[model samples]
Target: MTGPIEGWAGPASLGEGSVLTVVGAPHPVLARLGDPVDPTDPAVIRLAADLFATMAVSPGCVGLAAPQVGVSAQLFVVDVGAHPKTATLHGSFALCNATVVEASRWRPGREGCMSVPDLTGDVKRASRVVVTGQLPGSGQSVTITTDAFEARALQHEIDHCSGKLFLDRVSSAHAIYQRKVYL
Candidate 1:
């Protein structure tokens, strides 16, 4: 199950390990999409923290993945609730080896990507999703069912871990738009 179709541009380059990279793509090692993590490991925890920090500083970013920051690891952070206009996400989720177990058969929505900057496209995605992942520090598996904007945000970030850019999944380029000003 996938939600509406969206598109993004390619090769948003920043400083090395500055949260966006093109070299990270096409590297098979970068696509360890979902693998378990030892939550207690300080490095893992720090990685999650750094991801969150990066996300906070990034413009219009709702989520981020380790690979986006030039770290090939199964880690990502998401917080849909950070902005007022969007539906609130339940704070931050430091996910490791996150997997979608279920998804809703519903209409698709628009999406964008930090790695693929300046372009937004219509993409089909699961309107709702049930995801399972490990939470940092607890080493416990947690499941979350989300829909609408939140679901879209999660799917986009997770795609980065698998080297799947939003542009790859876009249903059409017709809806692509320029982000004139990012707040």
Candidate 2:
């Protein structure tokens, strides 16, 4: 049920979540690998909700990871539904301990991160991918096969969980561009 916008649902247990401040580049949390989280844990679920809330408020943010918010955990939330480049929409969902099991269709595309707000980079990434992870609240193991922008967004967040940034993926300084409009 990973097709279109059908499968994901934000868990009700999170309640009204408070949006946390997004930490920027040079933050130590963003540099270190995130600790794996127990998906069903109350704190993890709350963190997922906060990530969703923070992403919703931040303009042009398609995904957000725990490290970006100063949490050192393998948790993130994604929703590229509103972007013009989005192909497959998963609605909005939070994943814990996510990993990409399969990927192909490599292509270079412009990417920006909430943590690195001042720059955007041309990163080579898979346009199609198969990702596996557990849902935040239910802790249900799920596999998602997606393509286009959705795939790119997933990979970006996964990299964040892995202590890597789009800056690390760029071929060189020539591939990075300063963002004129912070969107």
Candidate 3:
């Protein structure tokens, strides 16, 4: 999945009561995947909008979730368009009530997270995945099947909604990497 590099200045921090909460290691909301969006509620739209904004401004970020910003809703945003390798991705998706309907049997992939800054780990993930979710504002449900990096990115964001970080799924702490610079 590739697309143009539309510049979006990500948000600095999750606003108070705005859903991007960093609850310690295991948050209850993070444990449970989110529910479908009503689309009629203004708060959900606002949270989605803020999440998009946050992802846009954060340098090198391909996706973001409501839990990352403290919101507990089943909402997340993804864009792989900027990745030079996955150029077919338009790099923009606003997902609500996202769920992985299918996944390929596979080993692990190196993964990272925005909530847990400066750490990377070899987290197990499906090599391929089919996901179903709605586009924010539009209330239109879209399902896409993806593999490789796109698949990995989607799974990472979905984990955030379920309160599961990449570190939690890592097979070994020795596989984790430390960030040398802030992107």
Candidate 4:
């Protein structure tokens, strides 16, 4: 759908899927906070692969966190590429237990999640942000300072790590919009 890899409801592989299942809202796992993951662990490597793969297969998905895959670990994969709205693309990358260290400016943007695909919401987010975390499978610290769509994607993924969804941050109940389609 997004790029003719497959259909939106089916597993779309950008890399290795691990054939992972993406958990949806009200599934207890979606509300659980992630524990810090050891970047040097082999499991972490596999997680990164699975996350990227799952993200690729999903239409309009730009980011995914460990919890979305039912893993209680702080890690996420993001790629602003392949998105028409993104000009400052970061390609594809994964972070382990990333934290947003700085944020500035504010804007409300429409956001939809793989976990809650039936809805979209206008959530207020920082337009610029800095996030630091260990690189997947490497135990090396990495920090990224980005603006626009990249920052919004980071905030969305990080919120998943914190057990928050765009629905929770919607300005009001009326702010939520029904999403009849994706991508």
Across 86-169, the per-residue lDDT of candidate 1 in tens digits comes to: 553555566777878898866667777776666777888987788877776556777777777887877887787676777778
Off by over 4 Å in 3: 1-35, 85-90, 105-107
Q: What is the C-alpha lDDT profile of model 4 across 43-113, one tens digit per residue?
A: 88788889977877887889999999998889898887777767565567788889999999999999999
Ranked candidates, highest lDDT first: 2, 4, 3, 1
In candidate 3, what are the lDDT values of residues 1-183, reduced to their tens digit?
433223322222222223343344455665666665664366876787677676767777888888776667788888776765452453566677888999997767666677767677888788788888766565666777777778888888888877678887888879889966845
The best candidate by TM-score is: 2
Q: Which ten residues in a row have the lowest lDDT in candidate 1?
A: 7-16
The C-alpha TM-scores of every prediction are 0.76, 0.94, 0.79, 0.88
Better of 2 and 3 by TM-score: 2
Q: Which ten residues in a row have the lowest lDDT in candidate 4?
A: 1-10
Model 1 spans with C-alpha error above 4 angstroms: 1-36
Q: Rank the candidates by TM-score, best first.
A: 2, 4, 3, 1
- In model 3, state the lDDT of residue 69: 69
Q: Which digits, one per residue and each the tens of the lDDT, describe model 2 over residues 86-164? A: 8877778888999999999999999998899889999999999999998888788888889999999999999999999
- Our model 1 lands, by Cα RMSD against the true structure, at 8.6
Pull out the clashing pairs in model 4.
Answer: 12-57, 74-97
Candidate 2 or 1, higher TM-score: 2
Worst 10 residues of 2 by lDDT: 1-10
